[model samples]
Every structure is written in structure tokens, then in C-alpha cells.
Target: MDGLHSQQNVDLEEFRRRVQQGNDPHGPVRETLSRLGDRWTPLILMILRTGIMRYTQLLKEINSMADSPVSQRILTLKLRACERDGFIQRTVIPTVPPQVEYGLTDLGQAMVQELNRLIGWLEVHEVQINACRAEYDAH
Candidate 1:
């Protein structure tokens, strides 16, 4: 029992080192996950996946579909954060009005694809999940 416990502790420590250490590859993934988990970013990325979109266009589409619309200030902040994180590319067109557009970068597209897979899984298991939640809540 002691030997098994010692091995489990070693494994747990290694897990922490890989995930928590800056030099470890997993640390960056953890950081990116935290950023991507924000409220409006997933919606923004999903919209951008179709094609490049103007700021107002994307904002309108997102706000229309959401229960509580994202404010212009919040949307701008999330867009800047996404651009900074290399998840989206921003292009400014010098028209009479100076239009700005956003599109998913290669990295962003890849991430959206992965996120879709997770959403698909959730859709498939939603019934089971609800049942489990009900059971847990009853107890």
C-alpha cells in the first residue's frame, strides 16, 4: 500500500510540473484555454469562421443570437484579446469610413474545429447529462 501511494504521489507531482511549469508545453495550452473560455470569444470565433466580417456585422450577428447582447466595449476588448492571442487576424480597410474586418487565423480555425467536436459530444450526451444532474440533485 505504501509503495502504491508513493507512486501515485510521484505521478501527481509530474502532472503538476508538466501543467504548471512555464517551460512545459502544457502550460501555454492551459493559458490559452483560460482565455478562450471567456463569454463572447467562442461566439466571435464561430462567426468569424464563416468568412471575414466587419466589426458591426459581427457584433450585430452575435448580439442578435445571444440572450444578453454584448456591449460594444466588451466586444472590442474581446476582439483585441483574440487578436493578441493569435486566434484572429484584424484588417483595417482605409475606405471613406475606414472599415475594419476580422477573420480567423489558421490557429483560430483549428481551435474552432476542435471546439465544434466538443460541442458535438455534448449534444450527443445531453440527455444522459441531464439525467445524471437530476439524480445528483435529488440526493
Candidate 2:
């Protein structure tokens, strides 16, 4: 097999070993993906890649750019989840009223590179994916 297929085979083997439907429902990879798989998580994580942003800035970015806009309550939940997962950092500055900001942690920064590649792959394959969906629906 070519290198790409060979690597994918190796990855598949690794995944099989790590994740069992019954025994290991929440393996490291699976669990991590579960956290990141949420629509808001990746959006929040990626938005922080640019640098530290206040809550309103993050909210604005997601609402303006993402297909599904988030309400303040939902945004709070997603932000808390990301922070709990160690993928993002939250800072509360003490001032007249106090200010809150968010940014990526080291782990989150590393993941952004992979996220970018994943986005690129999706862009490349989107047409084929849509075509497959259309064909599948037609049949």
C-alpha cells in the first residue's frame, strides 16, 4: 500500500485497539473528540487562536461568522466546557467592575494546527461529500 493508505491502516489499528464499543466507550481519543466535536467548542477554540478576546468579542465573532448563532447562556456553557477541558484559559481581571477574557492554552494552541488542517481537508472534500449525499439521497 502507498504511504497514505499505510498510515491510515496503522491509525485504524490504533483506534480499534484504543476504542471498544462496550469496554472502552470513552478512550482518550474518543473522549477528546467528543469534547471537540461540539459545534461551539471548535469555534470558540479557533477564535481564541488569534489572541486573547473578551467575552463580547468572542460572542460577536461566533454570532457574526458561524451558521448557528449562540445565545449568552449557551455561550457561557460552551466556554465553561472548553475551559474545563484545559483547551482554553479564562482570565478575570479585577478593575472597576472586572473584565473577562479568553485565550488558548498550550494544548489548545497545538490543536489549532490540526484543526486548520482538518478545515482545509473539509474544504477540499466538501464537493465530493455533497455529491455523495445527493447520490445517496437519490438512491
Candidate 3:
């Protein structure tokens, strides 16, 4: 079993080296990450994870965060990008006053489980992460 695992690891390393050397076996994955890794995308995704929300609500919620208050221009750009990437759906309500709401698409909802897992991991390891940061700063 250990020998099999070692062989698997070697194969993975070789694959990674080949990919790094411009033999991209996974070009689509790289492209997707490149498209989605903008500054505001993750924050928008995180906020929408709660549920569907109106545009103003999202803006206010983002603004309330001290560490990352997304500018209106950047938020507009990110939302448009997400829409183009099929990560989210935007709806406009027809009424005396128009209302706009945003929610995750099917593909975006698929990410929630993984996102939750990541958040759980962060919560579990937060103490260690903070300790490491403090130790590094003190050095």
C-alpha cells in the first residue's frame, strides 16, 4: 500500500512538473481560476452564500466590513464578471420602483458545499493560524 501511494505521489509530481513546463494538461482549470480570482469575487460569493440579496443590501453588507469595503465601481465590475462567468444570476423586478436581486446560479450553488468545508477548516484551525501570525510578527 505504501509503495502504491509513493508511486502515485511520484506520478503526481511528474504531472505537476510537466504542467509547469508549459505542458498544460489542465488548461481549463487554470483559465477558470484566472477568471474567478479577482479581488471582489470571493467576497461577493461569500456574502451571497447566505441567500439571495438585493443590490443595495449587498453593497451595504460589503461596506460594513472594515477589512474589505468594496467600491461601487469594483463591485459593478465583479458582479458583471460573475454574471458573464455563469457563477451568479441577476434579476430585475418590474414595479413602480425597480428592484434588483442577485443569487447564485446552479454552478455557484455547487460551490457552497466546498466553501462551507473551507470555512469549517478555517474555523477549526483559526487558533493555530493566529498563533503562527503572531509568532512570525514577533520574530
Candidate 4:
């Protein structure tokens, strides 16, 4: 198999093993999912993948991609959550007006790579997935 497919399978097997073994693997898995699996978190991460961005820049960038713009309060909450989870680093610059920037941490970068792998897999199997969905819907 190709390197990507091989790596994907290996990762899947490792994940399966982790989930299958031990008594409470679900707790850790669920914690991770609950932390990062929110509606806006993925989009925020995807934007951060580009480079460091100021708060307003991130807000505008995400808003451009989203059909419904996110509220400032919600954005603040997401950023705080990402920061708390150690997925993103928030840097503050003490200027006359105070400037802040956000970028992916090492952990965040690793998560982005994993997300890429999943995205690649989805791209590869999208047609098949659509076909299956259609078949199921017809039945």
C-alpha cells in the first residue's frame, strides 16, 4: 500500500487498540472529543493552520468562511478553550492599545497533522461514502 494509506491504517489500529484495551479508555477519548469536537473548534484550528493571527484577524477570517458569523462572545469562549486545552498559544504584546496573537502550539500542530490525515482519507473515500449514503437512503 501507499505510505499514506499504510500510516492511516497503522494509526487506526493504534486507536482501536487504545479504545479496546483497559477499563476506562472511553473517559480519555470522550474528554478529547468533548474538548475539541465542538462546532467551531475545527474551523478555528483550520484558520490557525495558516499562521499566527490577531483576534480580529481570526474573527474576520473565520467569519469569511462561515455562513453565519460567530459572535464575539462565542469566539472568545472558543479561543479560551483552545488555550486551556494547550492546543493554541496566546501571546500578548503590551502596546499602547495591547495587541494579542494566537498560533498553534506543538500539540496543536500535531493535531493539525492528524486532522490532515483524516481529511485525506475522507477525500479518498468520498465517492464511496456518497454512494453508500445514497444506497441506504433509497432502501
Task: For each candidate in the order shown, give its overall lDDT on alpha carbons.
Answer: 0.90, 0.87, 0.81, 0.89
Best by TM-score: 1
In terms of lDDT, which candidate is strongest?
Answer: 1
On a 0 to 1 TM-score scale, where does candidate 3 land against the true structure?
0.71
Tens digits of per-residue lDDT, candidate 3, 103-124, equal 9988877766666788799999
Model 4: lDDT of residue 5: 100
Identify the runs in model 3 with alpha carbons over 4 angstroms from their true place: 1-6, 9-28, 31-39, 134-139
Better of 3 and 4 by lDDT: 4
- CA error at residue 93 for candidate 1, angstroms: 0.2
Give me the displacement of residue 73 in model 4, in angstroms.
Answer: 1.1
Instruction: Tell me which of candidates 2 and 4 scores higher on TM-score.
Output: 2
Residue pairs in steric clash, candidate 3?
none
Which candidate would rank higher by lDDT, 2 or 3? Answer: 2
RMSD in Å for model 4: 5.9
Candidate 1 lDDT over 1-139, as tens digits, reads: 9999999999999988866664554456666777678888889988899999999999999989899999999999999988988999999999998999999999999999988998899999999999999999999
Residue 138, model 1: Cα distance from true site in angstroms: 1.0
Query: For residues 1-139, could you state the per-residue lDDT of candidate 2 as single tens digits?
Result: 5999999999998887766642555555665687678878888888899999999999999999888789999999988877876888999999978999999999889989899999999999999999999999998
Better of 2 and 4 by lDDT: 4
Stretches > 4 Å off in candidate 2 = 1-13, 21-28
Ranking, lDDT, top scorer first: 1, 4, 2, 3
